[model samples]
Target: MAYPQHTTTGMTTHPDLTEMRERLERTASSSGAIAVEGLILLTGVYTAISPWAVQFSSQTNITVSNLIAGVTTALIGLGLALAPERMFRLAWAIVPLGFWLVVSPWVVTPTHGARPGIVWSNCLAGGVTALLGLIAMGLTVRVARQSPR
Candidate 1:
């Protein structure tokens, strides 16, 4: 798993040649996290627009909640993706956000009727978010364990 590197002296180097190729290994491992972060961001955007897209914008309470949650989730995903070294630990927080999304239909007041579509949409998105959050947490733990301690 040798990766190309350029030295200050205009020379090529293969740091992966070292006995402990931690940096290269870490970069390789982070691909999954990057993908998950993108999915999380997409979910957030979907959640935010779901109320209108589903024709349930009348439910102002749920709409507002979803908007707030969606924006926050997107921001967190962006933060983790852009600054994993400093923000990976924040990944765990997204789990609770997912849980909130899952239960939001019941928690937030809706306008006159119970919309099954809204419930299902949130549940589906939330379930995916929470599942990915768990996976991210596991990967973070694994990476930490693999680091020289």
Candidate 2:
């Protein structure tokens, strides 16, 4: 019996398995874009649903506001995840979204003003969203700087 050679040759040689594995490892790493995108996505979802989660849906205006912001944030997160190369710059926009979420209780509250639960919920969600946006922006900037001009 003859043993087949471990190597084969072709016009396109076998891809570098080590390099491919390394790339897969990098892509699946916790710090990778997918992970961050997931965080952003969750943040948006929480923000949108906070009115119900925190039981402040009685305030129609605030509920609507949160729904809008949450949906928008989720969409942005999705865009970033799906087309990061094109949408990375939009990360900066998230900073403002975060700010809006933070202040939405005040701005979107009924003339009665904001409830404590609403205030706290918006603040927390907004802060997290803003922080995540900042992280996304920082990552984008770092990647840009590292890329060859």
| Tens-digit lDDT track of model 2 for 37-149 | 88999999998899899998888898998999899899999887776666777888888889998888778765789988889889999999999899888777665444222
- What is the alpha-carbon lDDT of model 1 when measured against the actual structure? 0.78
lDDT of 2 at 145: 47
lDDT by residue for model 1 over 52-101, one digit each (tens)? 98888887888998899888888878877777766677779889889999
Q: In candidate 2, what residue range of length 10 has the lowest lDDT sum?
A: 21-30
Candidate 2 vs. true structure, TM-score:
0.75
Residue pairs with backbone overlap in model 1: none
TM values, all candidates: 0.77, 0.75
User: Candidate 2 regions off by >4 Å?
Assistant: 1-30, 147-149
